[model samples]
Target: MIRHLVLFKLNDGVRRDDPRVVEGVAAFRALGDLIPELRFWECEWNISDRPVAYDFAINSAVEDTDALKRYLEHPAHTAGVALWREFATWVIADYPF
Candidate 1:
């Protein structure tokens, strides 16, 4: 299996309650159902108030590199990325497990 993880830090002025962010979160939250390659999925707002913590996170898994590619290129995921692109910067890690 391959694990995919992403952590997002909101833009300077962006807040979790912003309508656009809410929609973006909803979009990402729907991705597991929309895509068949996902074997595991979890998304949540970060509870940490520490200086280095990201504001949001996605933890997911797929069967392999091919499945991972499909998930990344899926239209629903692309759309969600576009939405989040406007409000956050993120970091990602993917690895075989």
Candidate 2:
């Protein structure tokens, strides 16, 4: 399986409660149901205030690289990314285990 992890940092001045951020969170939360390639999905707001902490995170899994690609290309996923582009930047890693 491929574990797909992402850390997201909200743009400066963008609060988690902001309407856009709230909607973005919901968008990601709904992705698992929308995409069959997503074998697992979990997203959450960060609670830590550590300097290295990001504002949110996404932890997901897929059968393999191909399924991962499908998940990444899904329209719902792309739309979520587009919405996030307006208020955040993210970093990701995918590894097999």
Candidate 3:
């Protein structure tokens, strides 16, 4: 399986309660149910206020690289990324287990 992880940092002046952020969060949260290639999904807002902490995170799993590609290319996932791009920057990593 491939474990895909992401960390998101909201742009300066962007608040967690902002409407756009709320929608983006919901959109990403729904992907697990919308995409068949996803074997697992976990998306959440960060509670920590530390300077090094990201504002949000995604932890997901898929069968393999092919499935991971399908998940990334899905319309819902693309839409979520587009929405997030407006207010945040992120980093990601994928590894096999």
Candidate 1 vs. true structure, TM-score: 0.98
> Please, what are the lDDT tens digits per residue for candidate 3 over residues 49-97?
9989999999999999999999999999999999999999999999999
lDDT of 2 by residue, 1-97 (tens): 9999999999999999999999999999999899999888999998999999999999999999999998989999999999999999999999997
Q: State model 2's lDDT.
A: 0.95
Worst 10 residues of 3 by lDDT: 38-47
Assess every candidate by TM-score. 0.98, 0.98, 0.98
Considering lDDT, where higher is better, how would the candidates rank from best to worst? 1, 3, 2
RMSD for all candidates, in order, please: 0.5, 0.6, 0.5
As for model 1, its CA RMSD to the true structure in angstroms is 0.5
Assess candidate 3 and give its lDDT.
0.97
lDDT of 1 by residue, 14-86 (tens): 9999998999999999998999999999999999999999999999999999999999999999999999999
lDDT of every model, 2 decimals: 0.97, 0.95, 0.97
What candidate 3 gets wrong by more than 4 Å, as runs, is none
Clashing pairs in 1: none
Rank list by TM-score: 1, 3, 2
Clashes, model 1:
0
Better of 2 and 3 by lDDT: 3
* Better model by TM-score: candidate 1 vs candidate 2: 1
